[model samples]
Target: MKRVWIAVALLLAVLAGTLSHSFYLNSFTQELTGLLEAAEAKAEQNEWASAEELTQLAHHKWDEKTAYLHILLRHSETDEVYTSFREVAEFIQCQEGGEYSAANARLIAELELLAEAEQLNLKNIL
Candidate 1:
């Protein structure tokens, strides 16, 4: 009975950790996605200054999250996002519509994937 109770406690702790990671990843990505969409929309409307501001705001948020996220998530995934932000900022500076749009699209997709990987699902559990 004591052994069974210990096993349950361990399982619960793992489940809690998985759920926490998933929630954090999903919430951060959604916020970043909003920033990206706003920036992209500004770019589409030819508001370059507004687009740049939004991109910088998004980058600032990413930097803030990185401090804590590095402890919870894979470094590689964080690095991918960090790289994407730089590319987006560069494209915004050059006012390259196609490239900026493409980079944001890929960034959003990758963020979603990162969150999904952390969710407490059967595949992740197995």
Candidate 2:
């Protein structure tokens, strides 16, 4: 009888832990999704400042060690949205006889690296 009780307790504990983890992941994913949407909207409006801000918010809210992989994969499909805004911004600068700064180039490179890393990580997850 004692052994049966111990087994039951262990099972309950495991189940509870699993449930808690699932809930947390779901909540985090929802927040990440919202952030992604905000970024997309900002990009669509050619609001680079807002888009960058949204991306930063997403990064801060993400679980970098784990959630980042999933977010990266998701972001990959939306790259064109972001790239479009960036290109437009650059083109505007160019037309004004202003050079696209090295900083802007570096930022784009960083974004690409993040997307690639996310893609690779998604494969690993699968």
Using TM-score as the measure, which candidate wins?
Answer: 1
TM-scores, in order shown?
Answer: 0.89, 0.52
Error in Å for residue 112 of model 1? 1.4
**Model 1 alpha-carbon drift over 4 Å, by segment:** 123-126
Candidate 2 at residue 126, lDDT? 75
lDDT tens per residue, model 2, 1-126: 999999999999986765565455455555655665665565557675775676566555543533444443455534543554455345433432123233333444444444443332346367
Instruction: Please give the CA lDDT of all the candidate structures.
Output: 0.87, 0.51
Q: Among all windows of ten consecutive residues in candidate 2, which has the lowest summed lDDT?
A: 95-104
Among residues 3 or more apart in sequence or in different chains, the pairs in candidate 2 whose N, CA or C atoms overlap within 3 Å are none
lDDT per residue as tens, model 1, 26-97:
898888888888988999999989989988998899898887878888899899989988998889899999
Give the lDDT of residue 55 in candidate 2: 56
> What is the number of backbone collisions in each predicted candidate, taken in the order shown?
0, 0
The C-alpha RMSD in Å for every predicted model, in order, reads 1.6, 9.8
